[model samples]
Target: MAVLEGDCEDSVSDSAKSCQTQSCTNCGGDGSCNMNSVCNNGCLPGFYSLACAQSCGKCGGNGSCNRLSRFCDESSCLPRYFGPLCIQLCPLNCGGDGSCDFQTANCLQGCKSRFSGTRCELSVACPSSTCRDPCQSINGGICTSGCRSGYFGEICNRVCNCQNNGACVQDTGVCESISQTTSVTVPTKFSDGKTAYQRAPAEGDPNNYGS
Candidate 1:
């Protein structure tokens, strides 16, 4: 009888041990069947899994991440929205973060100044209405704002400082007139009985033979 009782106790002990092992394996050795451990706590709403690695659609406003389940709750603003479930307006432009003047989109400021064109895209302007020629000898030699060069005369044709006896050649420096010539004329006559012939003064002669 004593041996049978001892065997029965031993059998009961083995069964309890087996039950504990089964429970531990089912509960990950924590000894308690915690709902958090068994239930998919990490998964987002409408999602359930051992790993909780699934999407649950966009949370309406800012969502909160569950600490234990890592689930997103659509009860507030998102990170970029930065409010109670993402209900507030973004500080910068929601799309591009460009300048948002009075809630209306306009040209944003750019790196350069004095440019108001698209996307703040424009080059610097000339000082006046016109840009100067790159080849002028003197700075600002070419006139701007419709004031033209060569205005002193035709194509800048005004007389240069070169004066008296000096002639302005085309594109050449001034040149001066040099020598002058004078001439004298004398007359002589000869009668050939039929007519009288007169010879104009020969070069170096006061008169020819006066027959």
Candidate 2:
């Protein structure tokens, strides 16, 4: 709804003409005649014009793009971002919003927590109290890989010391197939000598002679 630069034409003279009427005669609610009687109206938010059609490319702070050029206003892009559309991300670990200079790639405002360096590129180690795995400093400071033996958890902090010579699953710490524990459950056998070694769970016998 803001006034943007434009001019009413004089076909023969090829120049802007003063208003003949007192107020604007022809224009939509979104359009206007300026104080100087110049025909002007900024485009609706997200729309540049019928020629460009549709959304204005991610202007910073949700500001409207210029109606004609559609370029973002200077310093209008979000922090740590820049480019034709302001969709480009700043280098990793930049501090405040708009902190990364799109031109220089430096964190001019300093680094985010747990990240250090002129450009905020280095990862600072998290204390074991917060993140148990030393692996947090590596792999972009995320510990997604499974924990070492004898430990398990989201952060691989919980102990997995299974009791009685039991082996634990690295993910869930559930005791599983180990020396003393047998998952195989043999079925009960019939009294007859032939059925003594038959399948355990099946009723009667393999010969079907005895119940």
Candidate 3:
């Protein structure tokens, strides 16, 4: 009476355990053992259902699907692909392997000769600005979470100020805007939104704008 899943007594033989891949015969594929040793890990990619007899829609990059409920991987699709699990392909002349926008599937590299559209089929979406935050750098004037690697700023709009691949502080903005040889103007407006021209009341200096 094996009742605690994989905690089966070593006395039980492989034949009695189900499959060699450690897959459950009850699950028809990879699965964990239940109290009765019934597996439930689900089936291989592109398969579904208890018997694992169903086929899934075309997924991105031929990725896998939820074998148990048929849920699809929305982000796994390769370039030129879109829709749920990337089941759909971009237009024929969408240009550049259909590496279109993820949201609209519009090409980002522009259209081919004699073919034209407002977006040129070449497109892209606001990619993640930071791994920990969503990207809306264009729409949002300021970064809510922070900047991505190799970048730092309030809105994540400014490029890495350091040369030779140096890093900068987030709120400090202390890094050089460019390499030593390059001539570039630095931006003002400190972290507190005050400039060198503006006198601080705390410093006993006369305020320029208002009290």
Candidate 4:
């Protein structure tokens, strides 16, 4: 009887040890076991592993990582950050007013009127004093507003020399003038419509009016 009781106690002790081993292994040490004995607690936010021991890659604290794959969740990236791991920053700060492409970092909208280039990093080249009326029809180095007085041509770099109160053509820089000439004529009138005849006897006279 003593031997039998001892064996029974030993058997109970072995059973308890087995139960504890099964309970601990159910969750693979990576998650908590639920009431149904199913592993459901999953790894922490940025960590993933069978035992929740590995850390997620650097996501600049802007996104969450997948528990199973340890990859960053792009949809959760911070405002200005983008890319697979949310590691890249949007370029040009969206040119101050526009937005940037989340994947390519390119500008979603065009730059402002005062700016140009793919990233809007370059300033629009407006005409200067040398070109006259810098803001008039500004287009790079070309002076579409036309040069100021005394200046002419596409760049407004050419000087003009108009003569005799002449003005230079804005497009060609050629001198132009507006001068005119006039003439006058006088007509003689006769007292009578018929011709007058002098007497032949008076031809020899020294005081003849016909002479």
Candidate 1 lDDT by residue in tens digits, 168-195? 3323333222211112233444364444
Tell me the spans in candidate 3 whose CA falls farther than 4 Å from its real position: 1-39, 118-211
Task: List runs of model 2 lying over 4 Å from the truth.
Answer: 1-29, 32-40, 97-99, 124-211
Candidate 2 or 4, higher TM-score? 2
Worst 10-residue lDDT window for candidate 2 reads 196-205
| lDDT order of candidates, top first | 2, 3, 4, 1
| TM-score per model over all chains | 0.16, 0.35, 0.34, 0.31
lDDT of each: 0.30, 0.51, 0.50, 0.48
lDDT of 3 by residue, 85-164 (tens): 45677666555565666557666555543344634532323334442275432222345566765566665555565555
Mind giving the per-residue lDDT tens digits that candidate 4 earns over 1-211? Answer: 0011222342243443332222323233344543233345655566554444556554435434665776675443444555666556655524444545556655555554445455556575543464556533213345666666665666666765543323456688764432211111233334765444433222133322231
Backbone clash count, each prediction separately: 14, 4, 9, 0
Candidate 1 has what TM-score?
0.16
Where does the lowest 10-residue lDDT sum fall in candidate 3?
A: 178-187
Better of 1 and 3 by TM-score: 3
